[model samples]
Target chain A: MEYTYTRSVGPVIDRFFSGLADRKIQGIKGSDGKVIVPPTEYDPYTGETLSEFVDVADAGTVTTWAWVTDPRPGQPLQKPFAWALVQLDGADTAMLHAVDAGDESRMSTGMRVKVHWCDEPVADLAAIEYFEPEAS
Target chain B: MRDIAVVATAQSPAIRKEERRNEVEILMPVVHDLRKRAGLKQEDIGFTVSGSCDYLQGQAFAFVTALDAIGPWPPIDESHVEMDGAWALYEAWTRLQYGDIDTALVYSFGKSSPGDIRRILSLQLDPYYLVPLWPDTVAMAALQARALLESDGVTEKDLAEVVSRSRKNAKDNPNAQLSGDVDVDTLLKEPMYLSPLRKHDCPPITDGAAAVILAADDRARELTDRPAWIRGIDHRIEPHSLGVRNLADSPSTRTAGEKAGVGNGNVDVAELHAPFSHQEIILKRALGLGDNVNVNPSGGALASNGVMVAGLQRIIEAADRIMAGQADRAVAHATSGPALQQNLVAVLEGEK
Candidate 1:
């Protein structure tokens, strides 16, 4: 069975979706002075409303990762990939995404990766297909 | 806070699949057994509350169907939480403090076999950023496991020992679905299903239900001879996002443990709801439980994890020891959300 429903992303989420469409990554400066990608309207700690928008690099380092040897259906990658929490260059917190390194031996913590933009940009997380190893 | 105690508890045997029984079918026997032990009918109970996820049953208001087991003909005062039964028990405990309701019946059930368990769990993630990626529970857990491994220098052998010990402990628990005498060396030799995680490190996919009864003060003594009085009960949660949170440490569990006064007295036994082997390690550290504490003598969630039921089972296991006169003081811990984002801790003790 399948169903579809549409709802507004609201102000905070709307900004994220619109930014993804233009392939320009951005984060909101949290009350703690840290930038958070896919930002939340209120500070996680203090619950204060946040407004400052900050641009972040499309590249970042892997903070921690899990190697998925067997991919499940509906997952981002068909082949084996590492699910990583990458700390985007300017963002204080990491964002979850898959890294499409060919082999398990190739993936490691602290490795740098750049976002792989989708062929046809869409206003969702799928706009960035997956992260790839950064060119040294 | 008024003194409340767990007077009676019952749990169905955990199994990989209940092909013949529906969710309601799986719950009926357990609820009947619990009420029978408490010697109370639906009408006698002041309130009824349950915890279960509608997503698991694949229908809206799926929990309402399970109410049939409780015989809600007279329309019992009831509530529901889309969480593990442990949280429902927590709510019931709080409601008992109002002094109007002296007794409450709590239950939770789940059948992870009927659906794509992993994919279905992904729906719990943030809709805008995480849900679209479809990260399974195991994969998400592996991220925390990996982080724990790197930060603490824990080896796969250490993880294997936890799995071996959990399964070995299950040998004594009839409700546990998985149990046996196993060697850590043999387990360590097994292939990795997810890098840094062996198959044993993950919990079994289980279908089961559990029911518990809570009574306040005099009513508790009337229901059970040795009531497991709740000395302290509290819960805390971390931010929803996994990115900013420290995967290596469970600050939520720590805070909840502190609030529950786990360190105030000696804990004879501790029941922790850790679905993964490494998570048990994290919980132990968070609770500040020493080697002196007997942890998960019932095999815990690693032996039989029925998504919404396991957490409550932890409380029952701890309370069971107290009622049996095996332990005087004990602690029960429950967790919800991925990577131990939310934690509930309850300290229980027998009559002083």
Candidate 2:
């Protein structure tokens, strides 16, 4: 059995998805100068509308991560991977994404990772595919 | 605020699966037991409210079917919340404030064995971003656990101790699903199911139901010899996006605890609904509970967590201790949403 539902992403969210489709990530500046990726309309803490958008580097440092030994259906990867909270360069906040590190031993806090974009542009979260260890 | 008290409570023993019994069947005996304890009939209940998720049962209006347990034939003032029973009790408490009603029946049930609970819970996330990733419950919890470990300087051994203590405390709980003496050293030796979290650190998926009979003032005293009077109650929620907030701390919990007056007096006992061991540590800090306070003496969610009823069970645990003359003041906490995104705190006290 299957079911389907549809919704409008609205202006604030639409801006973020549209940017993702073009392979460019944008972070909006909050009242306190913190940059929020996958931008929100208002600051969660200050409750002020944010308008300034800054383009952040695709590569970032992993603030925290959890290794998943077994993959469940619909996850970004089929094999073992690490789900990380990555603080993209120039952004104060972090975004949640999968890290394609091969082994648990390879993943660590403060490790540098860069976004691996999908082969084709898709205006959704999957467009980012997953993050890979940054090349030295 | 009208003086509200938990006069009576009953809960089914937590089990992995009740293969033969349906939701109504699981709830009937619990409802009957509480009513009998309170010595009241269906008509005597001024209002009825319950909490349960339709997604778990895989059908819409699934809660309506459970009404059969209440025998709604003669018609009754009833309502339901698509959340944990703790929220349902909150609604009932609010209803009693109008002075039109003196008594209310609150209950909740969950049967998660029928479906893949992780997949079902995934639907609760924001559809566009978080839901598309389909991160399961444990994985989300793992994310928080890692953050807590990194920022708080807590070690894996600390998490193991919490697991060991929870199992040991659960031995006294007849309704608990997992209870016994577990060695902390052995737990640390076990492989990580989700890195930084051993299997013992997680709660057992359970099927169960619980009921509480609430009364105000004189009605409360008439129902039971000792009533667990609600001294203070408040709840709060953080942002829905996990990325937007700090995972290491529960600010919402801290706020609710302060507003609920958790620090107003000595807390003899506290029943915190921390399903994850690491979460228990975060909650203790959020509520500012000292070492003297007994936390999760009934083993808490780690021992037996009913999907929709565990939060209510925490309240019942605290109330039971109060009504039994074991404690004068206690704090009961309930959490909903992924990674403790929302929290409810209530202060229960016994009559002097």
Best model per DockQ: 1
Off by over 4 Å in 1: A1-6
List model 1 lDDT by residue over B181-253, tens digit each.
9899999889989988999999999999999999999999999999999999999989888898999899989
Q: Per-residue lDDT tens digits of candidate 2, residues B1-352? A: 8999999999999989889998889988999999999999989999999999999989999999988768786899999999999999999999998899899999999998889998999999888878888888898899899989999679888888888999999999999999999898998889999987888888999999999999999999998999999999999999877788789999999999999999999999999999999999999999999999999999999999999999999999999999999999999999999999999999999989
Candidate 1 per-residue lDDT, tens place, A16-131, comes to 87889999888999998999976888888889998888999999999999999899887889999999999999899999999999899999999999999998979878899999
Clashing pairs in 2: none
DockQ (CA atoms), all models: 0.81, 0.74
Best by TM-score: 1
Q: After superposition, how far is residue B275 of candidate 1 from its true place, in Å?
A: 0.3
Candidate 1 local distance difference test against the native: 0.93
True contacts kept of each: 0.79, 0.71
Candidate 2, residue B163: CA error in Å? Answer: 0.9
